[model samples]
Target: MEYFSILCILSLSVVTFSETCPKLNVTEPLLFGDKNSNTSYDEDEIISFSCVEERRLVGEQYAVCINGEFYVSQVPDCQEKCVHAECAKRIDGYCNEGGECVCRPGYALFNGSCIDKKSVKTVISLATKWIPDYDHNSSNDFKVLQADICASFDDVFEIFNYTLRCYVSFKKSNQVTIANVINDFTAESIEGPSDVEKAINGAIQLGHTVPGMRYNVTEDTKANSTYLKECDENSDICDDHYGTCNDIGKGNYKCSCIHGTYQSENIKVDGTDCSVAPIKVGLTVGLGIVCGIAVACFIPAYLWFIISPAFGKAEYNTAAAAEVGSTEDEDEDDEEERDHKDDLKRDLEEDEELDKQLIFHQTMIQNMSNFNPMPRVNRDSQSYGVPNSIELSTANSMDNFNHQQSN
Candidate 1:
């Protein structure tokens, strides 16, 4: 019997190595991804997988199964429950009796059983009144906030709905009055979430107002959240507020800042948030000083149009004196020119008389020297014969003197 058992073992071993290797079977793969990744199965999602513990690894440490053996390529697999899905590196939660994987941090045990914060939510409600006018003729049921958060709505609303009203207001972040339409106007605005909240806000802002209304929020009950709806991923308000936003109906969320505040912290920081930064108003006197200085700077403009032109009057007076001196000089030059013309006329008349006297002296010398009449002779024709030397000398002297005078 011992020999038969050894022979059977030998046969099984031979068959296992006979031109073949042992076949490998995978018990479904478990995947691991980065904690901060929002990729479920998007193009950017990088996931890696491996077989669970106590299972023979058919591939490498970050390996993924493509066809037969798991390959080592990065893949997407939040559906495969891996140890990386555990909350805060917690080593718990696995595939339970059902086929779906489990996650950590008290997550619901279905599908991939881990809570992704991106998939999480925080629900709030119309604390005092989210609307501008929430109390007109409106009669929608507004449940009261319970004293204890752990109590049921069915149990607490029966006792507290009557005492749950708050003064509605739209106050700015700087605590200034943006809008105040109280009275019956309040009752006209509170409707279901499906109505026009954005349109109402738009109209209010067109008149230079904000939609930040004040309200006294109370828990309907502690056992359950006030709103069971979810917010849309397209909504940045919920993310920007860190999920401390409004879950309108199913998947739409509105970023709800506290009554007297705006978003500075995330959603995790809630009620019991005490203290505030003191409000500041700029100094009006300092502004007045600046404006006063501005007006003072412009004072020189008055001088530019009025007083500065008076300084140029001295230069104008000097120019007027120079113009008067020039006129007097011009008049004196005209008088000198007229006096010289009169002297020239007198000289011309004297020269004309001297020429007539020289001609008479020449005639007398000619007659005495040639054909002598006793004292004077009328000689119209050329009747002068040869003149004596003495007579010719006298006539020549007269002619030379007359030429010198004419010149």
Candidate 2:
């Protein structure tokens, strides 16, 4: 029973030890910190994270392993960098993940408060409101329904199935207010509000404004019928903001700044702020300093080795040529000496055997009578009978031969 209980406990321990932690969803890559590959993380094991380029990680950047699970104090959001997209307008704005544009830091929505106070003061002549009088006994006979009222009857009345809604609006000091009414509706000077709405919306999307300009809408007329204020004439807003205004017809203007300039926060400067001035000056100074250093190091060596010799005095040139000629003469003399030595060595080797032969021939010629042209006497026949007193001499033999020749 004790052994069986111990076996059951061991089995339970094996099963518990083998269990792994659940997989955690890490949106950002694990670029730093803990690099353990074992998925079975113990408690308090921290893991760090980072986002891809052009994206910033918001909120907590680390997650801790707790109880076989990743516990994050705060979930991180990898937000896209604002400078990569919609931040080019000089207005503080950013682009979201869904590609929608929103304002960035240090900027709020444009309320009725005008950015160009000077332009508003100089350009705006008057301000008035066209209030709609909803009650009138003569016009009451024909019921006029607003756009909302018409849309409310869409389910009950099938004829109101069209999706478009016409709206009426007024322009005052570069600000716009709009109200929509039903189709086929007509009122005092508000008959062509739909076309005006389209034109105004298009102009606003294009970043143009008809500032301080009044427009009169005629009944049953297109938007072209209304006489809009000239953009160039009402361009005091751009001038006040230190920008250039290009006048598109029909009361539209586009504002812009000069090149190498940008609207920067936290600094007040004239003419778009000239953002690259410091960088340009820094690069120019750095390049000049580098060029000066290079020239200072190289010019002396170049002058010493190449330029001075090329343009030196005639005396110096002659001396140099003499030195070169002397070196060549020495080399030629050494070569001739080597050749002479080689010739002497060859002569000595060829004449060695001839010299020995010449010495032997001279010795034989000097003692001509010493050698005889006769056969040698046989030593074996004389060995048995000749006594030691009989000695043959070459001189005696030569004398005997001479006497015989004379007889």
Candidate 3:
């Protein structure tokens, strides 16, 4: 009985230890291993998850079965690996590994939308029909028409509250077509249809025609309808030096003249005939004014250069003559002053001589007054006769003295 009881306990323990985890319910993630084939995973069993092409797996890449449950830290998710946000909204488009938007087979990107090649060809044909002058052989014209129609359609559709869609061929095929068209156009130099050229000329001549049918068509179309001519290396229509032949459109050409050259007025000669451009009246007047001003300034400068030295010399001579005159006048004044001083000295000398003579005369008179008639009385009796001689001699001396004094 104890053995049976031990066996039952052992069986219960075995049943309890044998646990399993349920199948994962995550979307977009692919599970790998035998556990995926089964409804439940055994204890300690490992499972891995992965994502499809162009998608990245987010969260845990592996899960472990433990204690009747999967020990997954996080649920796995597959996200689209796209670089451009526009790819999300584009129809039939996906981002490649290089992070560029790619369209499906037979589809191309146009106006931010993926369109089929068939639709693109249809749009091209429609545009050609609408534009009667459209050159089917020219890829450039085709491309221009395509763009115009697409833009017009987009505008019309938007006015009605509708989304605009455009068509474009596969990039490689479109590029090849363009290359072939260019080669063909270069190889052939034949003119376009005469009927079409006539129509173009007629439209140009009328002057009053539909507006905005083609870009710059009215302005580009001349009376001669040169657009119908083909220009190439062999073409001699344009002047070799003054003009250059350029392709305008519709297998036609025109001459572009160099600066200072323009098309000749002769109607018989086309744009190829160039002549020297006439000078403008404004330019001529401006040149004349400039020249006149220059001459006016130059004459004054020349005269100043020629006459200035003469004026300077004349001024120097005048200053020198004035200096000489002043010096002569100063010399004359000095000589006069010396002469006046000599005359004054002579007058003073004369006065001094006269004073000395007067002093001598006064001394003589004083001496005569001091002399006494001393012996006059004593001699009067004794020598009356002799006295008379003495008296006569004294009188004579006195008379001589008086005459000398008066003189």
Candidate 4:
């Protein structure tokens, strides 16, 4: 009896284990079959898998229980689905399960398409000296005020949907109110501040007003609200080399180009990019002008001071040479004149010496003529009357002296 009882107990345990299967573990957004409330399934049972709204099911849709285990060939998945085919064709975006179109960062949905937020024209207005009739401190009252402001814009612009992206209040002298008005359908049609002002006045005419406030479209405040979305989404949008991003207002930014840089031509679409002017071209033009001026000045200066003076000096030297003769010939003539003067001086001295000698000779001849000469006596005087040798000698001497004096 004890052995039979143990055998029965073991058989009951085996049957219980074989009849049950573990529960499936699925993490995706899904809808289950009729037996979804049960934690586990019986043997040979089947469960169906389906995706929730805006999600499409992938892989196997059903799992079957074989023995004590669930058998599935491929795991099921629920992926996001786009219900509207236009969402895929419009831009690089997707439609969420809630049927809302989602665009990439820095982009916003406008006119059923995604576009850069900067390109969307927006208008901002300030209500000065505002005093609301209701309590402004209550959150509910504030929300109602925002809704009323948005409604006013919708009525004025004749747009069914107007989005208010910004609202701010200052706590000075009866509160100041500033609001951003945007209409996706008519954003591109807004011309300028005139259009904005007209719309604001129209809204005021339609009984959208504070107790003692006046609406004025502030053109300078356009940057404060229009670009806030893009700036907040990406603070580092400006390129580092070209410029810096500046937060002009709360959640608003503007890119300021650095010195020596300028806003690029695509500033409408790419506000953060800047470019430098062509420095090479400017430098070349400047150098060319300077060189041209230098050459112009140098040409006149060379002709006036250098070439003119050189020609004048050459002409003067040539005339002087013609008047005075060549330097070497003049020197030779001066030396020859000096030699002629020396020869004349020598001749005068020789003539003076000759005159002195002639005077001495004449004196000697006169003395000789004044002297009486006795005739020579000869021992043989009684001889013949013919002239003796001594007389002839004296006579020859006298004749020679007289001839010399006369000559």
How many residue pairs clash per model? 18, 0, 1, 0
Candidate 1 per-residue lDDT over residues 249-330, each given as its tens digit: 4222344434433333321223112122222235334444555554554445434434434644554455556667687765
Models, CA RMSD each: 54.6, 53.0, 60.7, 57.9
Give me the runs in candidate 2 sitting further than 4 Å from their true place. 1-231, 234-236, 239-242, 247-250, 266-282, 305-407
Q: Which stretches of candidate 3 lie over 4 Å from their true place?
A: 1-232, 247-254, 265-271, 320-407
Instruction: In angstroms, give how far residue 122 of model 4 lies from its true place.
Output: 8.2
Predicted candidate 3, C-alpha RMSD = 60.7
Ranking by lDDT: 4, 3, 2, 1
Candidate 2 global lDDT: 0.32
- What TM-score would each prediction reach against the true structure? 0.18, 0.22, 0.22, 0.27
| Top-scoring candidate (lDDT) | 4
Q: Once all C-alphas are superposed, what RMSD does model 4 give against the true structure?
A: 57.9
Q: Residue 173: error of model 3 in Å?
A: 36
By TM-score, the better pick of 1 and 3 is 3
Model 1 off-target regions past 4 Å?
1-280, 283-287, 323-407
Two-way lDDT contest, 1 vs 2, winner:
2
RMSD versus native structure for model 2: 53.0
Residue-wise lDDT of candidate 4 within 1-407, one digit each (tens)?
99897655533311222457666655447555644468888755666777777786643455555445554322344556444455557544544323333443344444344543322224444544444522242233333333334333434544323231222222323354544433222234444335545555554443324211223333233322233333333323454455555655322355566665666653322334566644455655665565566556545644554454466557555655665857876676566556755755665565555555555555654554454323212222121111111001111111232343344
In angstroms, the error of model 1 at 243 is 13
